[model samples]
Target: MFAGAAPLAAQFPSDSSEPLAHARELLRETPLVDGHNDLPWRVRELAAGDFDSLDIAVHQDSLHTDIPRLREGLVGAQFFVSYVPADLIGNGAARFALMQMDLIRRMVERYPETFVFVTTADGIESAHEAGKIAALTGLEGGHAIEGSLDVLRTFYDLGARYMTLTHWASHAWADAATDEPRHNGLSPFGELVVREMNRLGMLVDLSHVSDSTMMDAMRISEAPVIYSHSSARALDNHPRNVPDPILRRLSENDGIVMVNYSPTFISQEVRDWAVTRDSLVDSLRQAFTIVDVTAPDSMVVDTAGLRQAVAGWTETNPAPRAHLEQVADHIDHLAQVAGIDHVGFGSDYDGIDAIPQGLEDVSTFPAIVAELLRRGYSDEDVRKLLGQNFLRVLRGAEAVAERLQQEMDPIVATIPP
Candidate 1:
């Protein structure tokens, strides 16, 4: 966006500091936290490797996340999602969920000097003060509980802080953005889930819910909610993006929607191109019938890979920095629609195939801060977007949980005579 202003050599003159030196300094001052990332699940999937030797290169070998990379980005806390695909939830999902959680806990326990497990806002603060990356867990889909509150409570007892009501598949309790519209919104049982979440002190995440379902959640939830990872529907009109009306409601209720970093959710052009690529792949598959892709063993069809392939695909066919700017555009839109306080960063690392340009992984996050600073955001405002807004929501969630738990005598009655 800062185009033709000055020559590169002039901007980074040997006689003077880099033009962005101040921005870089401020970035270090900011406490970076991401709302959702599936790195733990990915790590679990590849039990094929050693986790102890994980560094930036090994982390980025497959996707976004690794200890060294997180330190480079100054990421203070991360809500590593124990995400299991919806269909896998019933038979193996629950066990996988437990394994993923234990993996995260073990990771922190082994690296006590580099990481700390945090369950509360205060804990996050203390861990940050101790110079460690505070790790938190959020169940990406409600189905992980297997349609039982007992299991939900057990997950919470295991350090799960929040749960998205539904995933791509609709559950008995709620509809997903990708579901076939059985209930149109939350079911009666879904409302009960909301109340249960309220009583349990866990945040209800609306990232993958439909528009009607988002409103339903905001209306019924006793605590302020979060969209763990979503973008602006106004920009791309994808089901994954939230509309302004819902954004306004999130703002009113003091909730936060962590902006996602998926390229398909950012630009219609990228989405269209992805469609074209898929069609091409289909044609080739029909013609040859030997492995879906000919581009070696690692030919990812998603936009991120397509952007940088053997043909120099996305790299040669660059979708302007404006496509990336649209990320900030959503930030601006949310500030206008939901108030500046309600928007935060929730990059879908390890979960999505394509990342928007300029935001490939954890280390590139300072680039986002630099972009925001370039757009005239003050240092204070940037800090909130980075982590403070989410911490505030967590504090409010704690209060709401305490108040709501008082009204549920059954959970307390289970304490025995």
Candidate 2:
């Protein structure tokens, strides 16, 4: 599957065409390294694992990402998320995770010319040199490992470089950002998981874990930790956003905080609206008997029926829109607090229901670059925010793994109920 030789954005004109041109020029030198994108899960939902149905080599309006859009965005590397819903943690979660991983591998296999499978920073640069997007795997949710160190190691073997310690729900061993604390941070097993991840050179992601968990991991992890997709909680006050205290710790730990683009995380006004909107949706779901909207099973969510049921509610209670500037504000705040070296982009594209106005799809990354440039961010600082920061974190993790293997034996600690 050969893609067009010309970049997609080359043909289109943006409002800030001058800055957009500058952004394109910068990307030519330093391509954007996105921390997370959920196109794999979207494919699972839309095509039921059938690549032929939603071939990314061609354009797909239903998705926020595609091969063409990625090229347009000048994405040097992407960590495609192999996400499993938290509800499935106990019931064959590990099996589902394998399936997700297989989908990502198949994606790379199917489009070799456009994407190159990569696990290391060097691999990313090599792929970029070949004019191909470096495809990396990131497992979202620790439940994917199902409480076994062997499973965690197996995922790393399968090309997953990072795993979010928890998702929306708390794991048996770890606490989640949104869920009530069960372990008061991380249980002994959770700490072991972090240590083992350190040993294996897998980046321990703190995106969905609780604040206490973030502190605990920072205190324990020999290697740097990453908030794969989070914003500044000081700005938005969401549980999913990182607090200032954690941002300060990231500088000492040598970690990076990839700011999330979710409207809920970016704007407090949007978050308030979302809360009301979600409450209304929940009420409608109960009234109309729709179960598991986010479930892997396509049959679990009656998409059309739910839409019709909630049509009036949606019309009356519209979702507030966030702007690209808000997204940059998050990056700015995170940089001011965490240092520019610790800030990067993680759009969470295809995973979130809506995006900010100027950043509607993958092709709009240049707009963000333009925004940062307008804010007096130097070309060098912008480059670090775009990709260099993440690359540094990746290299740091690899180095820690090498040193840990030399010094400490493999930890085999267990959780106690």
Candidate 3:
């Protein structure tokens, strides 16, 4: 399709009229890469509804995914994640993996030209080249292999480019970020998994692993890695958020920390309030020793307005402009802490319920750029945060992948848990 092939000129508002035009023009022309998206499962639900036809007539704001929204969002390239429950590990992982892959394949078959099933880096470029949004695959948990290295290889062959070692759940071979006992970093077999994944050319994602696990896995892996969707703990002290020291090391190793845009991660106040609220409520329960008494208050969230919603919720939320502004700040901060070359955008859109108000979905990317510009981010730095930095790390991960595959047959990689 030609550039003019897009109905963007006729179907939507123009750059001149839109308030966010400056950033929009830059983001529209640049490649906006989001590290993780749960659209495969969403596509599964939408396919039942015929996503090509969004008939969520009863509730249009169901989920933050669909073709019409994608078009409206104007995202250039994306990774549709195949996330399965980690409990499905051991023997059933491959079944879940096949089901998700089948869903992606069906999506392609249902909308051939609108989506491109890309395998190679060139294929990704070409898909976007053809005016189609490039849809690549990412497996959210390593448990998708069911303890079989052969199954892991099959997933790589089927076009999975990245795999998170663990999910929020523990795996037989690895520990997880939540509730599980530690596994002394990667198990011996888990280390083999990392070596094999390096061989397979798949990028190892670390968005949901424990800190101890993260350090240990980093030591064994030969290639650069990515925390596909994590924030700066320095800003918000959540375990999910990577700290400065880790960020510094990731920078030194040529890895990346794609900034996640979930409201909880983006706003410290929100996290604190949530934590405080829970703690306070828990205290009340123990005080009364009764079933507890915090129901109506917990349910009463003032979504009546974004301002009201954020007033009590804005922990580190700079103005939305500052949100974008700090996004640049984070880019610069991570670069300062990690290195100028390592920060990237891994906005976790759709997977979360809320985001920075003005910047709700992928389409609002231009607003971020506009904010960056207002804060004096040159076009050069703008390009790097938008996608270039992530691409560089991806290329490096791919390089390491090829080297490992030649050295070992099964690609075993450890992930977060």
Name every residue pair that clashes in candidate 2: none
Model 3 error, position 352 (Å): 0.9
Q: Against the hidden reference, what TM-scores do the models get?
A: 0.83, 0.90, 0.79
lDDT of 3 by residue, 208-278 (tens): 88777788778887878888888887776777778887887886578888888775676676677667655
Q: Tens digits of per-residue lDDT for model 1 on 101-125? A: 8887877776677888888989988
Clash pairs of candidate 1?
Answer: 307-314
Give the top-scoring candidate (lDDT): 2
- lDDT (CA) per prediction: 0.76, 0.88, 0.69
Which ranges of candidate 3 are over 4 A from the true structure? 1-19, 43-60, 87-91, 280-329, 411-417
Error of 3 at 338 (Å): 1.7
Could you give the candidate ranking by lDDT, starting with the highest? 2, 1, 3
Give each prediction's root-mean-square deviation over alpha carbons.
7.0, 6.8, 8.3
